[model samples]
Target: MDADVTDSAGTPADPDHRAGDTPQGRSQEEPGATDSTDGSEPVPQKDAPQDETPQGEATDADAPQGSGDEDKAESSDENKADREADGTGAQTWADHPKDGSASRRKRPWLRWAALGASFLVMISAGAGWWLYKKLDGNITTDTSAAAELKVYEKERPTPVVMDAQNILLIGSDSRSGDNRKYGRDDGGSQRSDTTILLHLAADRKSATAVSLPRDLMVEVPKCRTGDDKETREQFTQFNSAFELGGTACTIRTVERLTGIRIDHHMVVDFNGFKDMVDAVDGVEICLKEPIDDKDARLELPAGRQTLNGEEALGYVRARKTLGDGSDTERMERQQRFLGALVNKMQSNGVLLNPTRLYPVLDAATKSLTTDSGLDSLRDLYDLVRSMRDVPTDQVQFLTVPRQPYRQNVNRDELVQPDASELFKQLREDKPVAVVPADELKEKEKAQDEKPDDTGSDSESPTPTPTYSGSSAADDLCEQ
Candidate 1:
């Protein structure tokens, strides 16, 4: 049978009465009832019925909907924190799920390439510096010549004009080392086989190389030798001064003879000259007739040919076989050979190519013995730089006007007024007469052929006094 349920007040209840139904019905009846009864803030009871539901059903409904959103928010916050901690906010797509990372990856390779290029440049610079030092170290200086020259510094000729330069070039024939193979190695005294006084114009437009004969008779002044031994002043051949007292005595003698100041001097030996010739590959020469000389060890058929170092030495030294056995003819041949050598060195194949330039510089510096003014590579470079722009045609070679000595037929004597005039011109820094008749004729022909295209009136350069000399621009094979 159905039992009747009553409330706590003992009143009769409905037949369907429930235990939790009373609290929910009272909450709906008076929303402020709980607050008034407790004298405190009311508790939120809107979700009380849902909270009172079965635990399994509540978890299923809430966790799948509301709680799922809360869990996703928390997970997102954690991921952001991880990214901040790892400092990967700008991570690439390859490393993370981001766009535009391919472009960023490409930049690293470019940066590395630039860095590698810079490293290579630094290495190349270091290598260049090492090469410079190596080349600079090869040069040898003559301290003895410098010290001895200092003693007579006061006696040196003063420059008549600014920028006029004079240099003495001496070819030493000392048969002690490599040169001994070429000549008698009898332990003989060294002599100046060749002597040239080079004069550079004040304007730097022209140059003149005057060859002095070794057989010329001159009065050598008393000089102190390298060993501090003094020699009495005496009359002797021009080369004898060098034998007695070395470079210092030779310089003093030259100054006394010419009355022109020498700005610097260089002494070159046989080995050095050969090496220099070889460094440039070879120098071209033209022979008018076949040469077969046992003494000079030179054998060549007549015509144009390139001469190696050994052949060059022999060709320059060949006297009795090549020409009339006169020193003057040999000097002329030397001048021609030098002109060709200069042309070869200045060519692009040698000057522009580092492979060729290094050997040539090495050979040149190793063989040179210079004065204090031009003792180092830097000094020599400066000198060369000054003359690099000089035209080949303006480079002249001549012998001092000479005649047979009155006392001895074998010796030479300076032609009176002509020699004095040449020295005066050099002293005054004036351009000497060096125009060859052939060149003059060519110039006249060119002028006659040229049409006056522009009516511009340009004044012509003053004609230099013509002298008996040849230019470096002259063909080596020309008769």
Candidate 2:
């Protein structure tokens, strides 16, 4: 069924020449150019023809097979007549519909279905692009300078590699850019008020979160801040690393202290945590006693209570009412609540449901500043997916070991045995089993209450609160 077309020189047909007698076409030496078909060639007409031979009859040698020259001419005339019998007969492959069927033979519904499928694909692509842009727009990304960040393939005994997985978490009061409208004090004196070190087992089956005291004094490395305009470097509290340089410097300081490479880091401001809490409806906590801390504007009664955004923030941040008024208790409370929060987020299907997930993600994105490794939406998603099924007990919490610092009345020094082992476990990636004396006592008390052990439902001596509102109490229990 293939019709072979050739040019005047008997080669394949070229676009340069066709049936219409354009200037180029008329100049071409077609086989029929020498014979007269309509008397003589028409005189040159400005738009129609110029100096070119007239269309002519075929030669005897060029006639159809098994036919005389006269018969061949007659057949040619009849074919031309048949072509004109139909309407305009000019045709090309494109003239047939895309499915290789003629327009008359195509099914109307099939064409429409194909068009609808194409439209849906285009819409899906556009939505994916928009989502990427929206999420990407909110993140502040940092990648270690490829040339500046040293990479050592040689096996060296590094702290992070020596212990379980270590991750650093920072909570900032930063009010830069759009945050100014939120009425936060993110101006000149911004410090990482809350810092946590997360330790995961070598198998990554469990984790322990340890809080670092913001008020503790530590050797701070020099750092640069501001643009070229207001940049400065100084040594102060470890928390000052954020104010001086930023997350990069803060990461460097923690790495120097623990001798462990932080695999990831996250910072959330006041509003970010608040929005996340509100989106989740709130978190539940069991408080046996009431707390009233004026600095944090907290007031609550003893017993279990569900806290809203403001109350939860107050509970985590208040230091005045917590045990011995020390930062360590505050860290413990933060860890307890954080474990609860993770459980809540997982059970609530925050990751599985897009309708619920987007708001949380939006809040987190707005509040977050991270290293370049976690800059994108995809990167954050992958990290969440990895830790989604980690058991709650596996996510343990602890405090960095410290004791009274001789240099300051209000500061601390790293404790012996416990603190060193803690760092050692982190370096070795081992699990930590820490049982506070009071918690151990409570467990023993519950065991004693078994019906067989007590023999009676009668009352026993009232148990002293291992965690009472004594001088030992930290403000973390306030609300």
Candidate 3:
């Protein structure tokens, strides 16, 4: 059976004007209004007496096809609707079923869901922006050092390589504020406990860190102090430059020695170092002998052990208890430990994983005081990201060649040509090689153990020259 078409909510279908309506039914309509049903002509009330005409008497030409009685029934309904509209207000789309249904079918939940999704996106975006701002703000700008550098801008060395970069990393031993727990607070006075000249190759395939000994004597330039007073230049210990005139003074001293432009610098305090170590959980190292240093606040056993921030700091800084009790040994330990730290970060997926990376970034940013070039989070992130792909074997750590000074065996001076060659290679952005300390030791031992070849004229193959240093990929366990 054919079903009757219906409106929304199962309501019977209806048109604007029924085919059975009479002239009187439209009598209550306003004047000059045209009949809207099927685009018919207007029904003018020219015959007022038609209202009283026989109810069932319909002119075939005037009426549409339908029974007279049915027309009378529909006409009655129309008359009632017209009368009600005249008494009350006209219907709006919300009240009229047909008009309201034509406007739209409402699905309120879908609307709420759209609004909810929009709100959630806004909240997430806000949180991300806030986090970026916080991290960006954490970096402290070395404006004072920058200002000091500007004063000697002309005196500074020009850059040799366009894309290559050299950053002066100074580990400040300042014992002020929270750092006092590590040592005495000498009224904010401090020295450069450790300094490394970090170079990044133009191709981004390698990085080399050269540690400068604190006892190495060099010519210190006349630099302006915090009080804006300049002191006379003199030949003195390298570390004294920091104690005398801060970062700018140290930079000047290093420039005079290396003749390489210092593009940017970072000064990290003792607390910062500790926090960074802790952020990466801990760095693992192999200890040959037991250590118990009261001054460094470190105590450990011989074996493979992971050292936390506090223990790691002490392990790197303890001079008298480790190796030959010399600053050279201390610097070597520091470099090797740093290499282990870098290897851990790469191997443990710290750089690739965001959850792990944030803590490390927080620790580093909080502790770093950098120049204007690298004082923002974006700059630092870009710098780190560029080096993330560098292979561990290419990341080398070594010290500038040095030997005991003739004037004092306790002091040191550059090893002349070896030091100059290294500097020249770096300044020209050329590749340099490094050998692991333990591997070098084993080779030396093997050479000593071999029998004397007095009867043989065997000539050894020429070997490529390499520095006595360690890479991040060096394994102490293999020693």
Per-prediction CA RMSD (Å): 15.3, 13.7, 10.2
- Flag the better candidate by TM-score, 2 or 3: 3
What total of clashing residue pairs does each candidate reach?
A: 1, 20, 0
lDDT values, one for every candidate: 0.76, 0.62, 0.82
TM-score of each: 0.73, 0.62, 0.75
* True-structure lDDT of candidate 1: 0.76
Off by over 4 Å in 3: 1-108, 437-465
Please give the TM-score that candidate 1 achieves against the real structure.
0.73
Per-residue lDDT of candidate 3, residues 1-479 (tens digit): 01111111133234665766523322234532433446565544332233433222344444566745664453334434664767532332123344232133456677789999999999999997888898898899989988888888999999989999999999998888888988888899979999999999999999999999999999999988888899899998999999999999999999999998999999998878888899999888888999999999999999998899999999999998989999998998898888888898999999889789888888898989999999998999889999999999999999999988889989989998889888888998988888866766787689799998878698876453467898999775543
- Candidates sorted by TM-score, descending order? 3, 1, 2
What would you estimate as the lDDT of candidate 3? 0.82
lDDT of 3 at 203: 94
Given candidate 1, what's the lDDT at residue 7? 18
